[model samples]
Target chain A: MLAFVLRRLVQSLLVMFFVALLAFSMFRFLGDPIAQMVGQDTSLQERERLRVELGLNDPVPVQFARYVAGVLKGEFGISYRIGRPVDELIAERLPATLELSFVAALFALLAGIPMGVYTGLYPDRWLSKVLLSLSLMGIALPTFLIGILLILIFGVNLGLLPTFGRGEVVHIGFWSTGFLTISGLKSLIMPAITLGMFQLALIMRLVRSEMLEVLRTDFIKFARARGLSNRAVYFGHALKNTLVPVITITGLQIGSIIAFAIITESVFQWPGMGLLFIQAIQFVDIPVMSTYLILIAFFFVVINLTVDLLYYAVDPRLRVHGGAGGK
Target chain B: MNGMENNVAAPVADTAPALLEVRSLRVEFPTRRGTLVAVDDVSFSLRAGEILGVVGESGAGKSMTGTAIIGLLEPPGRIAGGEILLEGRRIDNLDYERMRRIRGKEIGAIFQDPLTSLNPLYTVGRQLVETIRTHLTMTEAQARRHALDMLKEVGIPAAEERIDHYPHQFSGGMRQRVVIALALCAGPKLVIADEPTTALDVSIQAQIITLLKRLCRDHGTAVMLVTHDMGVIAEAADRVAVMYAGRLVEIGPAQAVIRDAHHPYTRGLMGSIPTIGRDVERLEQIDGSMPRLDAIPPGCAFNPRCRQRFGRCEREKPSLIGQGDRAVACWLHEQGEGAS
Candidate 1:
């Protein structure tokens, strides 16, 4: 078990290294931070000294090692556009993005799984057919369009909810949460729904197909024959098998949720990292843009590691020794 | 030898009422083209502790009949016209809850492939314990202990250590034994074993068959053994029913059926089992494949393939006709023994 975890940790480190290398190398060519930070009247010699101070002229490998060391110590330098430490800038917006993504992910799973199981168990039912048709729309329509439609319905026509922004956030230590206040939650509804809709539909479809596939397996039929109640046969035996594939998919979907939150954030004007990253792109803020890249890659690596561990937990076939597979 | 004929046939039927009985059972599958009859007018009875082997080629409806008896028939195929009774009570029309209650408690099933039959995600012990708890009112500890006992009963070595292992950890034969253990853990009165040994290595087949026979016999569990292997019928079956294209062609004492098959189809089946001493260039086989369900000839479904098919054989289907406990579904036996 320890060895398995160690192996995953080593792989995660390797993935982080490659992503850091890519981010550092790719973001440098987008003009220069010195040009963005300094005033127009600054002397050429002053600019050169600043460049040397920032180690811009250092060898690529040495700079990378220094960048790696700095990242390991939670330092992301100063954003070229804001002239504030990039870590501090991200920390301000991190809560909003994390809150939105987690809520969206939870909505996708809690609602999607039951819908998938229901549709799978009774593919011929009227309700299942209706859900399936509606899900098709969910998948077909673009995320931004869904957000616009939601805004139109609730904000413009019905006028029941706030249209944009994280309305009223409550500060809790390092975190700022919308969940603690009604106005904040009400404002969050449209964007969260818009962001979650596609994932919910995808997860529902994936789970439904997987449930169908698992139901056809011999063990499920054997489970039925063994007189395990319909509940046990369907959920206990069939659903668990379906979840193996579902877990891998849901993990990837969560990563995409955070990555794609840029569209939702821009649509709602939610003050999150996605919105910051977009601004960073416009102004060529290398530190902030690169930090976002490294952060997203880190999320993927961590999620994938968790997914592998979940596989070991859910499936006994993957357990090589007697240690980790607790009876 | 003519001396083999005995009126006291069907093993234990004379001593006790049938544990499981099928009266004119018919299974059908509806397609866009038509309703296809999979098992047509199949009727048989099994006495407690006796083994009744239903042998046939692939697509002969032997497995279908077994699945129907256990109320686990695949969708779009159902028992369109039939009455399956266990201990003189009709079970075919029971609701899902009632049927589920009966499934592992009174009637258990073992399928062809053991590798696929057991859930890969669960420990064999967990599978066994769950089935036991489902049918039997046992506490968790009691069920676990019962499961261990069952594993040992099915001949798994070191039940304690191996019970925690998953299905993939076991060999094919060992997996089948675990499957058998799962089936019989509830002490079901009847077991429907559908080609239980067909997927195992040849050397392992005999061992599984022997274990299944001894365990069921010791438990007084009547078994409907469905297989295409004639040698298996001869070895383990007390009585045998030979089916061709969804209908029973001959049924009698296994020895009698193997040695003196009255139906030409059964005779061909016996002849096809290659004998060691015979120097024939080719083995005997039916002349044609089974007619497709949609296009089955109007009379005997096997008539086109039967070498002894006559004018009457092609005009009308024959029901099981018998003397004492023996029966044959063929035109030759429609009248008396010598009518043909």
Candidate 2:
């Protein structure tokens, strides 16, 4: 297990390195950062002085090495557009994004699993059919549209919740979160639901189908034959069996949820990394944009690694194989 | 030559109360086309401590009958009309909750494919212990001890150590033994074993059969042993019922069923068994496959395949006619047909 984790850690680092390399090269090709910094009216000597300060005159290899060295020291350069340290800017926005993603994931799991299990257990029932169609709509509609619909219903028509922005953020040392206040929480609801809708639908459908398949397995029949209560057979045997696939999809969907949050965050105007990403894109803030790309890539790698480890924990077959591989 | 027959044919009085009884049980699968009667008018009784072997080809409704008996039939297939009685109390119409209570406590089921029968996620000991606790009101410690004893009873080596192991850790035969132990753990009055040895190797098949027979005997549990193997029926069963196309063709004492079968289907089944001393061009083959549920013939289901099929065999279905302790569902057994 230790060896397996170590191997995954090494792989994660290599993946991050490649992601950094790709993002750096791509940003370099997308136009000069110096042009964006000084603007069209800036004099030539001023531009050269700015380039020298930013070490742009150095060769590509030397620049990349410096960037890698700086990254290793937790320095991600500076956002030319905002004139702020890239890491500090991202750090300020990370918590809101984390908060929104966390709530969305929590909502998806809490609502999706039970709904999926219900629909699976009673596939023929009218309620399940309704839920199935509703979930289909949830998956079919785009995130921004869902976000607009949610704001239209709850924010505009009902007047029950706040429409946009993180209302009030509470700071604890370097970290900040919006869940500490009622208005902030209410503001979070619309964006979270919009962001999580697709994930909820995906999870529900995955779980429902996987559950339908698992419930038909011989072990479940054997479980029922053993005189286990319907609850035990469904929850204990069938549900546990369904988790491997469900968890795999859920893990993959986390990356997607973060990706979709970009749109959802824009739709609600929630102040998060997604909003930062958009602004960074408009102004050609290469350092900020690259950092965001690398950070999200890092998140994907780490999430996938965690999912693999979780698979080892949940499935004995995988554990045995993992053990053999370690040997 | 027939010494083993004597041991199995210990006659019981006709009046002995049956542990499990199915009366005119009909299981149907309703489809868009029409309802397919998977099990049609099947009636049988299992007495206490009796091993009743139900033998047939695949799709003979042998497994269907067993599943119906245990109230574990999959959806769309249900008991359209029937009365299942356990010790004279009707249980077929009971709700799922009540039926569940009676299942592990009164009747146990062992299915084919032992690998699929045991949950892979849990330890074998946990599975055994949970089943024990579900029916019996045993404490956790007591259940654990009982589970350990069951593992040992099923011939699992190192029961104490191996109990923690998952289903995949055991070989196929050993897994079946665990399934057997799980089925019999609560000491239910009756066990329904559906093709228990069909998934096992030929060499390992006999061992499992013997273990099942011996364990049930020790517990005085009546067994409805459903299988397609005639050899298993011959060796393990006290009584044998031959079924074809969702109906029982013949049922009698095992010795008589094997040696003096009245139904042509049963006789054909007996003849198909290759004997070491006898040599022939090829083993006897039943002429045709068992009919699909939708296409079962109007008269006797076996008429198309039977060499002895007569004019009446195609005109009318034959009901089981009792002759002493045995019954045969064929026109040949009718009073005017032949008494010789």
Runs in model 1 lying further than 4 Å from the true structure:
A28-66, A321-327, B1-15, B276-282, B338-340
User: What TM-score would you give candidate 2 relative to the actual structure?
Assistant: 0.95
In the range B134-209, model 1's lDDT, one tens digit per residue, is 9999999999999999999999988899999888888889999999998899999999999999998899999999
lDDT of 2 by residue, A1-327 (tens): 899889989998999888888877776667777876776889999999998998888887677789889899999998889888999999999999989999999999999999999999999999999999999999899989988888899889999988899998889999997879888888889899988888898889988998999988999989999999888899999999999988889999898788667898899898899999998887778788878988998899989998998888888977664221111
Model no. 1, DockQ: 0.47
Question: What is the lDDT for A25 in model 2?
Answer: 74
- Real A-B contacts recovered, model 1: 0.68
Q: In order, what lDDT does every prediction score?
A: 0.88, 0.87
Cα lDDT, model 1, residue B269: 87
- lDDT tens digits, residue span B183-216, model 2: 9899899999999999988999999999999999
In candidate 1, the residue pairs with backbone N, CA or C atoms under 3 Å apart (3 or more residues apart, or in different chains) clash, namely: none
Model 2 chain B weakest 10-residue run by lDDT: B1-10
Query: Which docking band does candidate 1 fall into?
Result: acceptable
**Candidate 2: where are CA atoms >4 Å away?**
A57-59, A321-327, B1-13, B336-340
